[model samples]
Target chain A: MLAGSQNRVQCTEIVLFGVNVAMSWAAVQGWFHKLASPPHFYVTAGRWVPWLGASTVVLLAVGLGWSLFIAPLDQYQGASTRIMYLHVPAAWMSIFVYLVMAGSAAVGLVWRMRLAEVIAASSAPLGAWFTFLALATGSLWGKPMWGTWWVWDARLTSELLLLFLYLGFMALQAAIPDRRAGARASALLALVGVVNIPIIHFSVVWWNTLHQPSSILRLGKPTIHPSILWPLLVMAIAFKLYYMTVVLLRARCALLERERSSAWVQQIVTEQIALCHPLR
Target chain B: MIVDPQTSPRLGRALRTVLVRDLTLALRRRGELANPLVFFVVVVTMFPLGLGPEVDLLARIAPGILWVAALLAALLSLEAMFHPDYQDGSLEQLLLTPHPLAVLVIAKVFAHWLTTGLPLLVLAPLLGVLLQLPESATGVLVISLALGTPTLSFIGAIAVALTVGLRRGGVLLSLLTLPLYVPVLIFGAGAVDSAAGGLSVVAHLSFLATLLILAISLAPWAIAAALRISLE
Candidate 1:
C-alpha cells in the first residue's frame, strides 16, 4: 500500500512538471504573438528607446573613460593599445549583429512577420557601420604595430568580407522596387551570407598561417588582467545597448513608413498634424 | 490528382524537358552562350598587357588571375539565367507544374553549366599558357575549373533568381554573388598554386569537390525559393 502511494505521488509530480512546461511555453508564444503585432511593437519599442539610449550614453561614457583613463597601459603596446576598447567592441558587434539579423531574417521567412523583416533590414546598416569601424580602427592600430596600414591578416580579411556581405544585403534591398519582396529577398541573402562568415574566418586563418607567420599580432590573451578585461566587457555591453537603441529607432521609422495606411498610424499622424497646426 | 503515367510523364521526364528546353534556348542565342567565354579570354589577355610582359610575375599570379577572371565571367553570364523565363511567363508555368521546382531548377543550372561553365573550363588551359603558368599546373587548372565552375553556376543561380524580377539586376547580382564566390576562388586557385610549387594539391582539390557537392545538393532549393519570392 505504501509503495502504491509513493508511485502515485511520483506520477503526480511528473504530471505537474509537464503542466508547468506547457504553461510556460504557451506564455512565451503569447508574448511573441503580442510582440509581432506592429502597433504593439511600435508602442513598446518607443517606450524602450529613450531608456536604451540613455543607458547607452552612460555606459559608453563610463566604459570609454574607464578604458582610456583608469585602465593601465599594455606593457608591450603602450598607449596604442587603447584602441582595443573600440576595435574589439566594434568587431564583436559586427558578428553579433549579423547573427541577430540572420535570426530575425529566419523568423521573418518562416512566420511571415513584418516586424522581423524590418528588424533585419534595419540591422544591416548598423552591422556595416560596426564592421567598417572595426576595419578602420584595426588599420589605425596596425600602422604602429605592423608598420603598414593594411595586411591580408586573417581577421581583417574576413572582416572586410563581412563588410562586403553587408553591402550586398543593402544593395539587394535597395534594388527591388516591391517593399515586401525586397525584404524577403534581402532576408534570403542574409541567410545565405551567414554561411560565409565561418568559411571566411577559417580560410583567412589558413591563408594567414601559410603566408605570414609572425606579422600580425593577436589582440588579447586568454588570461587577460581583470582591470583590462572589465573595461572591455563594459564597452561591449555599451555597444550592444547602442545597437538596440539605434536598431529600434530605425525599425520604428520603418514601421511608420510601412504602416502609413493603417488606422493606428493615421490616428498618430493626425495627432501630430493637429499639434503642429494649432491655428488650423 | 492521380498522375497517369501515359498522360503525364514522370518527374524525371519533366526535369529532362526543362534541361532540353533551356539548352535549346541557349543554343539559339549563340552570342549569349559565347559572351562569358569571350569575356574570360579578354580579361585573361588584358592581364598580360596591363601588367607588362613579365612572364615570371605573370606566371606567379596566373592561378589567381585565371580563377578571378573565370569567376567574373561566370557572374556576367548569370544575369540571363532566368531573366528570359521570368519575362516570358514560363517561370510561372514551371512553378505551377506538378513536379518539384527544385529538380527543374537544378536541371536549368545544369544546362547553364554545360553552356557557360564548360566553355570556360575548356578555355582555361589556353589562358593558363598565356599567363605563362607552368606546364604541369595546367592539368590542375583545368581540373579545378571543371570542379569549381559548376558550383559557381549553382550558387550564382540563387542570386540571379533573387534578382530576376528586378529591372536593374546586373549590378545587384554581382554585389550579392561575389562574396559567396570567394571560397571557390580560394580553393580553386590554391590548388593550382600548390601544383605550381610542386606541393601536394590533393587537399585543395578535395575542398573544391566538397564545395561542389554541397552546392549541388542545396543551391537548387534556394534558387527555387528565391524565384518564388521574386515572382510573388
Candidate 2:
C-alpha cells in the first residue's frame, strides 16, 4: 500500500512504483530465476526487440530533429552547443552501459546465470561504440568551440580510458578458449574495471587541477535553459532505447550460438517463427 | 608431494613458505632476474637516441618516461609470474591447498614485486640522472615508484591469473593491465613533476599511497577469482 497522493492516475502509478520498490527483492530474485533459462530469455527478448527498435526510431527522429533545428542557440557558444544532444547522451550512456554491463557481469558470476552472462558479454561492443561516439562528437565540438581538438579535462581523459577498458574487456573475452570460462573471467575483469572507474575519473580531475593551474575549458552552464535541457533529456532516453534494442538483438544471436545444442534451439531451428510469445 | 597444507595450518607459515619459495626460486634463476632490469635500462636509453638528447626536453619528460618505462618493465615480468607455476602443476596444487588462495596470492605478488619492482626502483635514479631529471626530484621519483610499482604488480596479478591459461596471452595481458595502470602513472609522474617545480608533493604521493592501499585490499580476491576461473 502506498501513501496518499493527489491525482487518481498518479496515485495508481505511485502505488505501482511503491510496490515495485517494496517487493523488489523477492520480485527481482524470481525475475532473474525466470530469465535465467536461456530459451525463455531468448523468446522474451525476441518479442521485445521490435517494439524497442520502433520506440528507438520514433524517439530518435523526434529528438534529433528538435535538437538540430528547433533548440535555441546558446548566447555565447551559438549552434555548436547542438552537438551536446549526441555528445552528452552518448557519453552518459558510455558510463551507464559500463555499470549495467558490470552489474550483470557480477550477477552472472555470482549466480552462474547463462542469460546474464550473455547480456554482460554482448554489452561490451555497444559500450565501446558509445564511448567512441562520445569521444568523436566531443572532439568535433571541442575543435570549433573550445579552439582545441582535445582537453585533458577529467571527463575527456576518463572517456578515453573507458574506451580502452571496453576494448580490454573484449580482448580478454576473446583470448580464453572455453566459452563459460571466458565469459566468467571477463566478467571478473569488468567488475574490477568498474571499481576503478571512479578512482580514475577523480584522480584525473585532481591531476588536471594540479597541473593546469588556470582552468581554461569550462563545462556547460550548470543551469541550462529548459529549451536545451528538454531536448537533451529526450536524446538521452532515445539513446538508451537504442542500446536496449541492439543489446537484445546481440543477446539473442549470442544465445542461439551458445545454445545451439540444446533441445529448445533444435526445436526453433526445425520450426521457423519459433518465438510464439513473450514470457508468460 | 601435496605436503599436506593442513600440516602448516598457520596462515603465517603458509604465507612465509610461499614467499620464501618464490624468492629462493627466483634467486636461483639469476639470469632471468636480469631480463626486466636490462629491459628497463634499454628502454630508458632508447629515449635519448630517439629524442636527440635535448637536456631540457628530456628533463621535462623524465618523470613520465621513467614511470612508464618502470610500468612496462614490471608488466614484462608479469607474463611469467604465474605461467610457469601453472605449467608445472604447482598452481593446481596451490589452488587445492586448504590455505586461503587470496592470502597466498598476496604473498606471490609481494615476492614478484620484491624481485621485479624493487630492482626498477633502484634503477630509476640512474635513469633519472641520464634523463637530466632535476636532482631534487630524483628522490621523489624513487619514492613515488616505490608506492606505485607494487600496486602495478598487485593489479597485474589479476590479469596474469585470468590469462595464464591461454597460449597467446601476452598481448591480451598488456591490453588488460595497461588501462588500469593509468591512475598510478598519472600520480607517480605527477609527484615527480611537482617536485621538480619545487611545489608541494604530498598530494600526489598520498594519492599513490591510496592507490597502493586500494590495490592491496581488493586485488587479492580478484586474482583468486580469476585463478579459479582459469583453472576451472
DockQ per model, Cα: 0.77, 0.81
Worst 10 residues of 2 chain A by lDDT: A271-280
**Candidate 2 residues B51-159, lDDT tens each?**
8888899999999899999989989999778999999999999998778899999999999999999998888998899999999999999999999999999999999
Candidate 1: stretches off by over 4 Å:
A220-222, A274-280
Q: How many clashes in each candidate?
A: 0, 0
DockQ of 1: 0.77
Q: Mind listing the fnat for each candidate?
A: 0.68, 0.90
Highest TM-score model number: 1
**Poorest 10 consecutive residues by lDDT, candidate 1 chain B:** B1-10
| Candidate 2, superposed: residue stretches over 4 Å from native | A1-28, A213-216, A273-280, B1-6
Q: Give lDDT tens digits, candidate 1, residues B1-232.
A: 5667788879988988999999999999998788889999999889888989998999999999999999999999997789999889999999988788898898999998999999987899988998899999999999999999999999899999999988888888888898898889888999999999999999999989998998988888889899999998
Clashing residue pairs in candidate 2 (N, C-alpha, C atoms within 3 angstroms): none
Predicted candidate 2 versus true structure: per-residue lDDT over A2-85, tens digit per residue: 434447768788999988887997888888788789898989999999999999999999999999999988777888888989
lDDT of 1 by residue, A84-165 (tens): 9999999999999999999999899989999999999999999999999999999999999889999998889999999999
The CA lDDT of each predicted structure is 0.92, 0.91
